[model samples]
Target: MKIFIAGAGAMGSRFGFMLHQAGNEVSLIDGWQDHINAIIENGLEVNYNGQEFNIQIPIYNQKDLDINSKAELIIVFTKAMQLDEMMKDLQPIISKETKILCLLNGLGHEDVIDKYLPAENIYLGNTVWTAGMTGPGKVKLFGTGALELQNIVPGFEKEANEIAEALSSAGLNAKYSDDIKFSVYQKACVNGTMNGLCTLLDGNMNEVGATSTSKTMIWKIMEEFRAVADFENINLDLDYIYDKILEFNDINKLGNHYPSMYQDLIINHRKTEIDYINGAISRKGTKYGIPTPYCDFLTDLIHAKEDLLDAK
Candidate 1:
């Protein structure tokens, strides 16, 4: 598959490396100048599962990319806030046959994507794969993860399965799901709990889990998420989801890792996806007449943190 990964940040770069290693023709498009130049001059420095190596993959800033170069598949990894801008930038490369696989965190992204592409062309999915960036063009990928995605429109199961197979060929552990919406909500629960709370607490998953009332606090927030999901008719197993969130506290899993929001707000001093995660739930709650105090409070707190840090 000729693939172009939009927003080549930590997760994007990891996917680029893995797909390229699998002999698929892969290129990266990112807005970060230093990251683009670093890969073009040297290579993408990667530490995969504690094994360090370098690979020369083609990378470009979105503006510098050749507009005529079409893509068979474009995996979107942009921040939720930047998805529209990314779709606009990649428009020239998106042909009718191009399949867009969006694995971004949070909710309501498909609405944004719908403006640019037909429903059949959009694939919505989520992953538990974790990645971190050390600096421009360098990323650390740890732990194991799986992907669940589905075409928004039905009757494309064969095409969706083919895309899944291609991703699985690259060690992405991909599966074509019939209920990707449910999977997305499930994944959002992880981000909503970990990303906002961890960033506010200034701690990793382990620290949040180690807190005396971690479970109770997390449950409060997730219940809000569930209420919002219920309004949308997305059934979520609170017990199952709660147990999965608790597993993040284990050091052997993703306990030591700081989530993407933490890296954005604290480490890089940039804006976060709080609006898409907890804030999304809060907004939906308002629309559906459901009270989501915990989500609303967390959303406000994360924005306050961003303001305090002067985050852009």
Candidate 2:
């Protein structure tokens, strides 16, 4: 398969290398000039399962993307805020038969993609793999995880299955789900509880999970999320989710891992996906006349921090 990855950050680079190593043609499309240049010069460095290696794959910044290159699949890993711009920039590469998979962290992203490309070409999904970008052309894979995806448009299941199969063959642990929205909600709950707390405290996953205060905050956040999920008719059991999180913490799957939102804040990036995570719950609360004070308060605090950073 000819694949074009649309972010080329940690997640994108990790997937790109895996697919490339599996004997598939993969190219990266990203806006990070330094990262792209470094990859073109020295290949992409991937640290996986305690081993580090480099894989040579074609990478292009938005400016240098070849208009005529036909990609069978385009996996979008860009930040949520960049969706519109990326869709416009990638217009030339999207064909009618091409499948676009959004493995991003958020809700309501499918609507954005449908605005640019045909609905039939879009797929919605979520991933649990933890990865971090250390430097230009370098990505560290902290844990092996799974992917759950589903067809957003009618009559697209076969195509979605084919892509999932290819990703699985590349050792990505991809699975197809009839209830994609549930998968997305589950991931959002995890992110909403973990990412914001970690960013605010300037701590890694294990550090946050080990503290009493952090554990309390996580439960509070999850409670709010559970309330909002109930209002929205999304099937999620707070007790079950919390049990799973504790399991993850105990195994150190997230050991020494800094949340992606924290990394974005430290680097002075333009946006974080918090609005999609906690903010989404707050919005749903407003719509349903349900109270999510904890989530609302945290979302407001994070937005204020973001605003302060923007001013500087």
Candidate 3:
């Protein structure tokens, strides 16, 4: 498959490396000039599963990508706030036959994608795979993860399955989902609880989880998410989601790492996707006549932090 990855951050770069190593024609598009320059100068510096390799995959700044270039599959890893801008910039490569898969963290992304592409062309999914950057053009990818995805349009199972197979060929552990919306909400709960709290507290998973009040506080947040999700007819298993949150408390797992939001808001001084995560819950809860005090408060606090830091 001729693939293009939009965003090319930690997750995007990891996916691009894996797909390229699998012999797919992969190209990268990112707005980060330093990252673009670093890769173009020295290839992508990737440390995957304890092995290091320098693989030269074609890369471009969003504005520098040739308008005539086309892709069969375009995996979107752009931040939620930047999705619309990315969709606009990549318009020249989008076509009737192009399939777009969104692996971003949060909710209501499909609505933004819908403006640029038909329902049949949009695919939604989430992953447990993790990646991070040590510096520009350098990424550390560890552990194994699975991907779940479904096409938005009905009667597109065959095409969706084919895309899954292609991803699985690259060792992405892709699975076709019967209820992707449910999966999306499940992932959102995970992000909402961990990312929001960790960023506010300025701690990694272990530090945040070690707090005496962590469980109770996290439970309150998840309860709000569950309430809003249930109102939308998406029943979330609180126990199951809570257990997933607790897993990060173990130092041997993902405890030592800061989530993407922490990296964006604290370390990088960039704006976060709070509006898509907790903020989205707050908005939906308002629409559904449900109270989401925890989410509402967290959303407000994150925004205030952004303002205090003058985050771009």
Candidate 4:
């Protein structure tokens, strides 16, 4: 399969390398000049399981893209804020038969893609793996986890299954889920609780988990998320979700890992998916006349920090 990856940052580069190593034709589309040049000149440096390996794959900045290159699949790994513009820019390369898989965090990504592409061409999914870009052409794999995906439109299961099989073959642990939206929300809850807490505390997962204050705040955030999930009619058990997060914090899975949102704040980046996670809670709470003071407060706090950083 010819796979085109947009964003080509940590997760994107990792997926590109994985697919390429599995004997699939993969091309990366990214705007980062240094990253693109480094990968083209050298190769993508992947660090995983205490080992480092390099894989040579085609990398190009958006400006140099071949408008005519046909791809069987296009996996979007861009940050949520970039989704709209990236979808618009992808018009030149997308064909009718091309399947678009979005593994981005937050809700409303499918809406953004549908605005630019046909609904039938889109596939929705979420991932639990964590990765980060250390430097140009270098992506460190913090954790290897599973991906859950499904076709939102009817009659696309065969394509979705094919994509899942290819990812599984690459050792990605990809699976198809009929309840894709709920799965996305499940991961979003984890992100909402952990990501902002890590940012506020300036600590890794283990440190945050070890702190009484952080643990309490995580429970509060989960309560707010649970309310939102209930309002949205998404069937999620609060107990199950809470236990799952606590398990993840238990000195094994993500103990030393820094949440992605925390990394974004540290890098002085202007955007975050908090708007999708906690902000989603606040929005739905308002719509349903439910009190989400915790989410509302955290949303405002992150925005205030973002504003202060921007002012400086």
* TM-scores for all predictions: 0.98, 0.94, 0.98, 0.94
Q: By lDDT, who's the top model here?
A: 3
Deviation in angstroms for 182 in model 2? 0.5
If the candidates were sorted by their lDDT against the true structure, best first, what order would they fall in? 3, 1, 2, 4
lDDT of 2 by residue, 171-259 (tens): 99998899898888888898898788877777777877888787688888888887887776887888888876776666356667787
Candidate 4 has what TM-score? Answer: 0.94
Tens digits of lDDT, candidate 3, 201-249: 9999899989999888889989999999998899999999988878866
Q: How far is candidate 3 from the true structure (C-alpha RMSD, Å)?
A: 1.0
Instruction: Determine the backbone clash count of candidate 3.
Output: 0
After TM-score superposition, what is the CA distance of residue 30 in candidate 1 from its true location, in Å? Answer: 0.7
Local distance difference test, candidate 1: 0.91
Give the clashing pairs for model 4: none
| Per-residue lDDT of model 1, residues 1-312, tens digit only | 999999899999989999999999999999989889998888999999889989999887887667667999999998999899889889889889999999999998999998998989999988888899999989999989999899999899898999999999999999989899999998898788888888988899999889998888889988988888988999999899888987877888989999999998899998999899899998998999999998999989988888898998
Winner on lDDT between 1 and 2 is: 1
Residue 244 lDDT, candidate 4, scale 0-100: 74
C-alpha lDDT (0 to 100) for residue 12 of candidate 4: 92
User: All candidates: CA RMSD in angstroms?
Assistant: 0.9, 1.8, 1.0, 1.8
| Between candidates 3 and 4, the TM-score winner | 3
Residue 28 lDDT in candidate 1 = 96
| lDDT (Cα, 0-100) at 166 in candidate 1 | 98
